[model samples]
Target chain A: MIKKRFILNFPPDSGDKPFSYHLVKDYDIRINILKAEVYPGKRGSLLLELQGKKDNIEKGVEYLNKQNIICESLDKRIHFKEEKCIDCGNCTAVCFAGSLTMNRDSWKLEFDKEKCVVCELCIPACPLHLFEIDFR
Target chain B: MQKTKTYEEINLKLKSGKAVILTAEEVAKMALECSPEDILEKVDVVTTATFGAMCSSGAIINFGHASPPIRMEKIRLNGVPCYEGLAAVDSYIGATACDPDNPSYGGAHVIQDLLEGKDVLLEAWGKGTDCYPRKHIRTKINISTINEFTLFNPRNAYQNYNVAVNSTKKMIHTYMGTLLPNLRNATYSTSGELSPLLNDPGFRTIGLGTRIFLGGTQGFVVWPGTQFNTSKPKNEYGIPVSNSATIAVMGNLKEMSPEYLQAAYYDKYGVSLFVGIGIPIPILDVEMARRVSVNNSQIETSVLDYGTEGTPKLGQVTYSELQSGTIKIGGQKIRTAPVSSLSKARKIAGELKKWLQNGDFEITKPVQMFPKNTSLKSLKETEADND
Candidate 1:
């Protein structure tokens, strides 16, 4: 079994498709929707965490592609500018997922992308504007 | 009182490269395991530092007179308006002043650009005078071309500050950083034990004319900072429980480094300068030794709610608890973060320690001491009538 996070972008006209239904019913995958935004006529996006067998997860992505839904991995979604960062720890304050932290011994800021929930709080909380979100 | 070391003796040791120096973090740990006398015997100076967004900071610059000079009445540097009340070609560019077109970049960035030897566009509008008839002048200036550039901060190196939190339903943007609504998070700014003012809580060694490390260069404390409060309540460790004891510092801006100074922008709160400051405390006696030994657990600050009309006191938390990344406030476990950079502060302390160990930097006795009693006053509103 494996757990992975992905961002699913739905084509403007493809919102009627039962993407979550097919993934859960056919692929036997567990869906945890971290964030979702649905517009009436505009394109919509879903930030989801999928937990299932490796093969099933791969099959689910194929299904998403067939439905014209763009699915991308959640990794590298957050960009931390290290050189610009003063290692001030302001980003660590609003990081509820504990993805951003200070190494107590070295007193340096460290980022673990896997643990980020894409809350986007650190983007503005940073005084130096070091944290950036790359949704594309 | 008999002294363990004097300024003269420390100077001799520093000059001879025999003086022992320790960062405040190192000394704090040493004091935990060693006696006061042992600390005094082993250490000559304890270096303290803090790097945080000091909003009340700026530079006083004298752009050398133009070939056809004018009584400069208005000026803007890199599109950011500068204070033009000074003499011709002399202006004060404040850190918070930003270009109307670009809010993110401000006066601080201009100063950093100048320090990096980058030419900045200088535009001025002058009133045509008999002796100086140029009405408008446009030019570019760098640090080398400027006759004098001084980093004159009216208030900085805060002894202690507030832990900002948002208790209301809406999120708040403040200089303390963005606060999550419903007490979701708390943010603070201070170096705690390694802070200059905290290490010398009584302003004993830190006063007017005291030599300090400002932005990777030597600076002096020119005066007690604006809003220098002394009537605040103190903890058992004698550290102020709130924002107190600030120092106004002056240094040659040309001598500063970009690595030690930075321009910071909050989401909606605007621009501020991250100032790196370090002060070395001479171990003159056992009492001073003990003061430098005060650790994070012993230093506490009030957690004030910023979502209200005025900041309402929520409670207090120690630096140890805050640094733990979470603190229990109002029975809820709220995550915490610091606006100040401990890593940068540590670097400043280490750098200052190296300067002292190499005998390149000498600690000076304050020419004058700050007053022990001073009160902070608030501006009162008055109704105006046409006379």
Candidate 2:
């Protein structure tokens, strides 16, 4: 059970209520609105918990981008280095889920679009800091 | 079977232009969601001591670096960079060989040791002086007889050799007999004396003049008891019958029991009897090995007291001498002595020091190094190609 928390911010009275309403109705997500009485002179905050497939969650994030939520973020980030990588199959071999691969007759490494769970198991194998996860 | 897909087929978007930053918790969660295959598409390299797979040796492996990285990653999902030098060196070699972009550097800890004045064969033994008490006892018997004639006898003769001699002898041994006991008896006693006592063997034997020695036995007892309460009884009411406990407690009381007590002392003032257990030999060996390896030197045979019973004494051989194989311990030249000796050990130290210097030599070469900067354009082009 992987759980992630994200803080999404919106402009005050941007008329984005319809978008929020549509997301909750379509995606079956739970949302809580912060009451103005508890937090004086503050714009409303909506707490959301979305449970489903990772790809779907990503799609929801993309939807937020489409909805123009500027300060949208997940608790983690996936990082990679461009210069140090050699398309070696070592990381692929270590990855149990078959997340990494090497191009035939070439020194290029490849990652599966749908199969990656972002475990960062390959980060230590790459001594040049080619792979990393930023949870801050 | 799915034909082994080329790196390009995995993903084109992850060409190394952008950075992905995720917290440890987030990474773990993401890892759980995606399969290893899915992860391969986003990044060109993977690094960790533990690969999350069960079959692997669990040692850290570095894929992209030419030389071992200064800092190695830990076997954890927390995303903290833990450093394990030896594992890092080995893993760097493993990863470089597989990756085309990075060139391999042959592993070189042994070479490093040579630079630090360590001999290869004798390198296993550490450098230090140790003294241990060695006791030996022997018993022998001789018999003589004299004959005298009385007044009634016509001829009197004094026969010393020809007369019959009746002799009865009894020997009572102490340490090796009652206190230490022979190999079989020792084992039987330590383990429960069951029908198949042979199956679970213990001590070898206790010889004559073998009193409880201080250094080896006492040192072993103190650390473990302090850390985990291994040999000590569960409570103050419980008494320790084993010799190991008695020796450790008494030794500490004489030498530095106060130091150990001060370190573990709690702020609350109260009169309480603390029962502690002593550390085991193997555990001490492992910790010593780790410490020695980190220090970039091997331990000497003398430190471990190869021949002596239970004390640390000055060793005859110096670190340089043992590397050349002049000193011998336990029938073999002291190649790598553990930390337990290094003091009071003599003949073994000389042989060990000589062997170490002879075997301590090394050389190094650069295989392949990482490129300076790989642009996103190149990465995209590489990913587009099937080959």
lDDT of 1 by residue, B1-387 (tens): 345789999999999999999999999998889977888888889999999999999999999888788777989899999999998888999999998779988998898889899999999997788888999988888899999999999999998999999999998899988888999989989988899999999988888999999999999999999999988999998999999989999999888999999988888889999999999999998888889988999999999999998899999999999888789998999888888999999999999999998999989999999999998879766757734
* Model 1 / residue A25 / CA error / Å: 4.7
Candidate 1, CAPRI quality class derived from DockQ: medium
Give the alpha carbon lDDT tens digit for every residue of B26-86 in model 2: 2234455654344333322111010000000011222222221222222111111212344
Q: Between which residue pairs do clashes occur in model 1? A: none
Which 10 successive residues of model 1 chain B have the least lDDT summed? B378-387
Q: What residue runs in model 1 are displaced by over 4 Å at the alpha carbon?
A: A25-28, B1-3, B384-387
Q: Please tell me the TM-score of chain A for candidate 2.
A: 0.44
Docking class of 2: incorrect
TM of chain B, each? 0.97, 0.13
- C-alpha displacement of B361 in model 1, angstroms? 0.7
Fill in the DockQ of model 2.
Answer: 0.01
